[model samples]
Target: MNRTLYDLAGADPALRFSPFCWRTRMALAHKDLPVETIPWRFTEKERIAFSGQGLVPVLVDGERVLHDSWAIAEYLEETYPHCPSLFGGPEAQAVTRFVNAWTDAVLHPWVGRLVVRDILDVIRPEDRGYFRESREKRFGVTLEAFVAERETVLPEFRRALQPVRLVLRAQPFLAGEAPAYADYIVFGAFMWARGASAFRLLESDDPVHAWRERMLDLFDGLARRSPGHEV
Candidate 1:
């Protein structure tokens, strides 16, 4: 198909998982666009080099080439205005940016510390060295050292989710009655952890967990059907 997405995969090609990629996937689904996702591994940077940087979630919509999940989401919204709205309006779009930034800056990193080690075990063997080298450089610490105290710090990570819990307590979604780009932005991080590790990030009774269940059930169980941990 002309619409293609280079999605990050584990040793099993079916195991697609990357918070950023998941955002694009959900955006495409939100826009009712069909996409052919190509499984990509860490060391396979050359495969997506045409995008001008190393990353998955690269969108090739016919001749238009795009990278970055947020950019892709905007493109989809603008390109397919006839489709269901991903962002409700300009104000919502602007607000969604805050959600996107918080996710990329705060939630992603926190979840990474919890699941980064598990990722190494699932990635292809050949990609392990590259993953370790790159991650260590970015984190400035060995993976083992970085995640050594994950259990001890679990409470702190959950506490960081208070903002989301607060929102869900009042509305069914971060964007209000229905899911929107903002919801997808936050859910991507959870999908990342769910895909990589079986660790329980949210308590079963937590409002966040209830919201996650609602998200997973969206688009007829699209995220839930993906190969990943039940969490």
Candidate 2:
């Protein structure tokens, strides 16, 4: 089957950084599915308008069109049952849902505070204005103000990963001994940071940092091979 993904890209087309898109990309790789990713940008909404919504990570699989990372993951699991499982089973899938929710609600916001401002540096010139204005309005402050004192808040960001830290301390991956959709969900946020900023979000000794290393090594260093900061 021919699979294509509209992945969010930076000023350099190879710099794919959207956290949500990373989720889909990792999920596809987990299933051993090959995909052709089209580099997409913030202002390129018309390019993906066919998906009924303007978002990168729009998936075109055969004749079917899918949007949303979670929806695409579920579709892949059901459509390609013979492939590697993203979620171990029904019970694990249920738990993974919680991870997804926590990532979107808690982790993403925390990550945005740290690296969202940096994204402007990586995106196209046309995108910078929209990015700054929209983000400022949503955040109720300028991007500079929003991420001001990031160093001071770095500890809080690390503290927010306490749950992940506890899990990774006992296991190599968030999904038991191996990677899964749950791990991908959280890993996407790190990928977002890695692609857009040089700022270090994790210390060397952190368990979550180790887990991210393991994830980057998966699929023969698939995520690691991408254009991103070594941090």
Candidate 3:
């Protein structure tokens, strides 16, 4: 099958950083599917205009075109049932929905506050204006102002992760012993931070940090091999 993923990238082109795109990338990897990833920038909406939407992680798998990370995951699960399950079973898939929602609603906002400013440094200069204007209009502040108090709010962000920490304390992954779509949903946020900033979001001793390390090591360090900061 010819699989292509229009993934969000930075100025370097190799620097893929969108949290949603990471989710899809990790999902494709989890399914052991090989893909050709195209570097997509914010200003290059025309590149993906055929997908009928602007945002990427737009996957063209065979004759099917899909978008939205969670929707893409479900599509992969159903279309490739014989492949390793992205969601272990129907019951697990049902619960994974909550993880997906929490990551999108709570985790992403917190992470954005921490690293959205740094993203300006990584994206192409042409895209920076659009990124800044859009994000600042949404945030009602400049990128620097939005993340200025990250140090002060760091504890709040860590505290918000208690639910995830509690779970990781019991299992190797959010999806249980082995990673599934649930793990990827959360891991994608960290990947965004990794690709965009040098700031550390988790302490070395933190269980969440440990889980991220394991996640990075998965699939022969697929994520770790990507261009990103060590943190």
Model number with the top lDDT? 3
Model 2: per-residue Cα lDDT over 80-151, one tens digit each: 999999998889998899999999999999999999999999999999998898889999999999899899
TM-score result, candidate 1 = 0.98
Give each model a TM-score. Answer: 0.98, 0.98, 0.99
Clashes of each: 0, 0, 0
Q: Which regions in candidate 2 have their CA more than 4 angstroms from the true location?
A: none
Q: Looking at candidate 3, what is the lDDT of residue 29? A: 95
Q: In candidate 1, which residue ranges exceed 4 Å CA deviation?
A: none
lDDT tens readout by residue for model 1, 137-178: 999999999889999999999999999999999999999999
Worst 10-residue lDDT window, candidate 2: 169-178
Pairwise lDDT winner, candidates 1 and 3: 3
- Please identify which of the two predictions, 2 or 3, would achieve the higher lDDT against the true structure: 3
Backbone collision tally, model 1: 0
Worst 10 residues of 1 by lDDT: 88-97
Local distance difference test scores for all models: 0.92, 0.94, 0.95
Every candidate's CA RMSD: 0.9, 0.8, 0.7
